[model samples]
Target: MKHLRFLNKYFYKYKWWIIPGIFFVVISNFFGVIPAQVIGHAFNLITENIQIYRLFNGFERATVIYDIFSYSLFYFGMLVLILYLLRGLFLFFMRQTIILMSRHIEFDMKNEIYAHYQKLSLGFYRRNNTGDLMNRATEDVNRVRMYVGPAIMYTINTAVLFILVIYAMFSVNVTLALWCLLPLPVLVLIIYFVNTLINQKSEQIQEQLSKLSSFVQERFSGIRVIKSYVREDYTKEIFAAESQGYKDNAMGLVKVQALFYPTMLLLVGLSTILTVYIGGIQVIDGAITPGNIAEFIVYVNQLTFPVTMLGWVTTLIQRASASQKRINEFLQLKPDITSKNTESARLKGNIKFEHVNFTYPDTGIQALRDVSFEIGQGQFIAIIGRTGSGKSTLANLIMRMYDIDSGNITVDGNPLKGLNLNNYRNQIGFVPQEVFLFSDTIKNNIAFGLDQVTDEEVSTAAKNAAVYHNIVDFEHKFETMLGERGITLSGGQKQRVSIARALIKEPALLVFDDCLSAVDTRTEEEILRNLSKIMKDKTSILIAHRISTIKNADKIIVLDQGKIIEQGNHEQLLQQNGAYAEMYQNQLLEEENQSL
Candidate 1:
């Protein structure tokens, strides 16, 4: 239960309901004892040939035996009715309280977990499986909910039933009651073994289930590639293997569960037989009244039933423990980045990189080594590099996705580490290579960062990105639902929308990391032309694969193996006849051949 301590704060909030819930359980327990005593008394009246009317207190002697029998039946019926009513009250309050508690915990846990994910450094996400993380937050939280709700209710039921039934039995006949309890130690030992087995099996079952879920999510998200290569059968085979593994593990769990119930029933039955056998001889010897034997039987059933359920409760608790372990592991991970900005500072457009060095979190290989650069306000700079040549790393450094190992990055000479990240990011706009658009109207996607923007402003940004006409062609125009990931839009259209989103921010600095790679040359040129028009007085960093995309930039930086090898305008680099010259010559030759 210590694993659940993190939830205590939420649980404590509803103390009012919990307190009443406990009271109801106590009242229910007291009422539950009544039925057993009445049943025992009725049995004694029937067996000892006593007047049943007199056997029930407050009932006068009756001439007709039918009247006496009816009175006895009435007494028994009332006892059962009251007990059942209290039981219902108990269940209702218990269910309501547990559900409220679980709901509170689940809601807060998800919020905290997601907030933590948002604060984590990009390197952390790069090393972890996103699908599994989602499982931990959603499915794993649900598992915790189950434990808090049903598991708690059953635990309380078992404990209350055990104590009350034991007291009732001892009050009626201590000797037979002790005889009935003789199998308890053996039953406990069996339960311990069962709990251990169940825990082990449940862990395996959950692991396989997670693997299956991750496999399914990955394949479904990449279904286009699977269909493109006509590898449907191969994909199916792989999915079948994963699915069969989950099935086998689940079946094993069923087998364990199958044995759990019957074994519990057998032990309870054995305890019952022992009580009846020992109590009968005492009755025949006239050592105890027959009513005592009947009450003893009722008490015995109450005791055995709860003890049997104890086994089932133990199983659920073990499974819950397994779930808690997974959830706790995720919660315990310390984020690589910290938001310790006790004093907020506004950002300036001037950016600087001073001998910055960085390495991938998982691999020690340096991604950026002693690289230094500076960009003042209103400069249009382009970064060109071969694959894995640290172009993206430089952009990431500015975003503070990964902290530098040495030196510093600053905005207007203010160290990034000292400034509030949220405040700093608000002054910059970032557009990534892979465009992500939510399922919403085009207007909403464009104005996502800003709370409110005029319709004129939205149209202006879309027009500048060269996507305004395309949006207007839609039947709903700005109101059209984009569908998931903007699936309803074309790839080039998605790229343009993303560009428009960045443009609308109207930030002091805009970073486009290969944002226009999808569009045709003409569209790309037009978008860039529009960007220059709007961002004439803002710092801009453009990363691109095509030389033509950045030919007219104020300056270009060529990176190779985490170091800048050249920096100049396209004309100067062309005349220098170095790495940049070679790249340009290759592009020029390819275009010339295409024209031919």
Candidate 2:
């Protein structure tokens, strides 16, 4: 309930619809009660005139009495029919208002959640799974919507109808009303207890269903692996066991729900019997007429559903409250990384790292220590290292994905944290080792980040990345649609496409983190040759293991065990005979052997 208080602003924001819907609910219920009153009056008219009809019997204007009585009943029935029609119309308006408002709120909530997700830092995503995040946005929000829409609607409808019917009952015959309503409170109490049991069983069933779905999804996603391992029988048996569990849970729920309707009917039937018995006594004593008894029966019947719904309405609110609590957990989370400045700052890519130190927060592994370097504007700097030697960590720091634990990183003489985050990132073109492409056309993927791009620009970027021929070979050329994660292309093709995507931006700084690993040396050299023409005045950082890739870099930095080991040009490092020279010699020998 405390967490659900967050929705108060939304309720107030959409109060126009809610207020009108409430009005319509009351108006509809008002019309709804009139039908029972009219039905009672009709009964009275028929009961009173039956004797008069008999008095004129035996062919002495008896036919005239019959005609008058028949017309009177028809008129009263038509009034009841008109009253229900009017009730139905208002009910429709009520749904249009309140239900529609709930939908609007749902839409806004999903967008707000997704926008917040974008604002959260990478650490938050690492701390949570995708499924849980999606459930908070979709499943939980849906439950809250039920509270705002149907639960509220039924609650209001029941309360209003109860008040009107009870008032009418007391006004007619207090004694009969008292007897008729005796079973009602008992009915509510029993239903509440039984309904709680049913809800527990239902939640168990839902849990089993989720497990089944997860099992099936995993099996499908890893079908190839299972088949390769020849574990089809093993997985099949596991699935069968889960299915059995689901059936057992469902059966338990069905059994509990079986008690729901019968209990309601029994209690309602008791109330009805009490109404007739007590009203008969009143009639014999001349305290009330048979019409009064009929009216009491109608009122009891009218109240049967709303009284029964109290338990279900409470259940919905309880579920919604729980769900809203989960939603609030994410909404209240402030990101670890926040931009200190909003204004877009111009940068020329003079990056300096002074005694920077960082550790992976989630894993508690120190990835960089005492890393110091300076890249002047328009410098082609390369970083070479063994696997897990902090090469990518340096790139991540430069991208500002995470802040350092100590020391300062300044870009263009401005503190990295103090500069506009978006402005800084927008000017840099970064191609990660693991490439990801959207399930869209090649042209769109290449031109993804820019709002407006011409076909020529996309083609030029493709050519510069040495993947132009691949595009022209496709059936739809640039318009060819790819499968998930660009699975339709080979690894080298995907990497090249990602390069094209980054190059399309023509950013001030380009960071390629082992992006050309999949391509052959010839293609890699061709790509470097083409890029050199465009990178004449822009800063570039190349992180790679291959010496052939970075031998021509203006300056090279060698890292080992999370610390800088060497820094020099290729010739100077070869003269120094350090780790860089050893890697260069090994690669040169491998290339010579391949040629032989």
Candidate 3:
């Protein structure tokens, strides 16, 4: 129960529903209990051992209304009839109330979790799977709903049944009641031990289940690649191992639950046998009437059923506890990058990195070391470096993907730490190396968060990306549905669509991290020409390997081994005959040889 504190706010928000649910549960239990007691009275009357005139408490002496048989039959039948109808109606209400509360809370919690994921920085995603996080939002929340819903109903039903049954037994005869309760201590001890086992085993089962889900999702998403590489058997081996682990864990829980019902029956059987034997002696001695014994036995059986349900409820609660802990751990995690300030929209694209050093957390190798650079507003700059030379790391730093180990990054002459992170991010646009699109129409993907953008604006952005003509050629044009990750589109088309997405934002700072790598040289040249014209006044950072891509840039920074070895315009670096000069010469010679 203490593990459920993470849901405190959600519970408070929906107490209106929860309160009504509790009321319905209590009322429903009342209807449920009354029928059981009435049944006991009916049994005594069927044997002609108790008089119908004394139905309530045997307090009346005058029998004027009806004969014993007729009166007992009608009164007892009406009691059962009313109880059954009312019980069904109340149960219907209870089901509606609990479902409403559960679904409402589930909706709110899933929304909250999704909103929190949005608030988290990119570094959080680097260490987690998209599918697993999605499970927490979808499956785990529903599991929690089940726990809150039926757990509440059964908990109330269990408590109410125990109290009502105990009261009914004592009312019949105190000595018989005492004997009926004698097995309670042993039953409780067995239940406690069984519940402990169920809790422990159920937790392991849920963990293994999550692992199985993650394995299947990942493998299916990459199934084509596995087939291409001919790793089918290898993948199957891994999947089978994961699936078997889930089976073993689940079976362990089954074994624990299997023992629970039998132990419960044994306790109930012992109590029943003792009740019949002791009450038989009391009847023979004329200490108590046989009708009383019959009534007491029926109430005892009613009590045992709810107690049996606890075994299953115990299993669910324990499984729920395990799931809650995983979800709570995720919710409680602090992002790698966070801003403490409250100001909004303060960034102006003036970025400065001063003697910054960084190393990946898991691997101790420095990704960027003592790197220093600055860019003024509206300046178009290019970053050029060989593979593994930390070119991408600089682009990542602008978005604060990984924090620097030392020194500072300032935007618009103010430290980035003092600006609201979300506000700052909204002012920047990025086109990543890998192009990804959702399984939605092209129009929604382009307009994304710009609610007020017209179709004209989307068309203009797409035209600038050099993909508008290609899209218009499709049967659906801009309304065409793209497959997941834009699998339906060609490689160059996907890259251009991603570029169009970034262009649509019209951000003050636009960073292209290898955006033109997929297209041929001719297409790349045309796209860069268009981008250069449109972004003349906007601050832009282009990360590329082709010298032709960044030759006309206002500034070019060359990096090698996590340090900037050269910085200049294209002509200035060409004259130096240094690192940039060698790269330019090799590309020029390669093209010249191809033409020959």
Which candidate's lDDT is highest? 2
Per-residue accuracy of model 1 over 38-105 as CA lDDT, tens digit each: 77777766654455545654544445665666677787778788777887777677777766776877
Residues 1-596, candidate 3: write the lDDT tens digits: 77777777777877887777777767776776677667766766665534444463444443442456677778888988888788788778877877777788888888888888987777677778776787778767777877877876787768866876787677767888888888889878887787778777767776776777788888887878999999999999998998899888888889888888888877777778878888889889997766666666767677778778887777777777777877887889777777787778645678899999988775577888899999988888999999988988898888877778899999988887777877777878888777788899888888775768899999999998889999999999999999877888999999998889888988888999988988888888888888888777788999999999999888999999999999999999999889999999999999999999
Clashing pairs in 2: none
Give the CA lDDT, 0 to 100, for residue 366 in model 1.
90
| Tens digits of per-residue lDDT for model 2, 1-596 | 67779989899999999999999999999998888888888888988889887787797688888988999989998899999999999999999999999999889889989999888888888877655677778877888899888898999999889888989999998888889888777776776677566556655654565567668766875786999999999999999999999899778766655666577777878989999999999999999988888888888888888766765676677667767777888999987778979888767989999999999999899998898999999999999999999999899889988889998999999889888898889998999988999999999999987999999999999999999999999999999999877888999999999999999999999999999999998999999998898888899999998988998998999999899999989999999998888898898899899999
In Å, residue 264's CA in model 1 sits off its true spot by 0.9
Write down the TM-score of every candidate.
Answer: 0.94, 0.93, 0.93
Off by over 4 Å in 3: 49-68
lDDT of each: 0.81, 0.87, 0.81
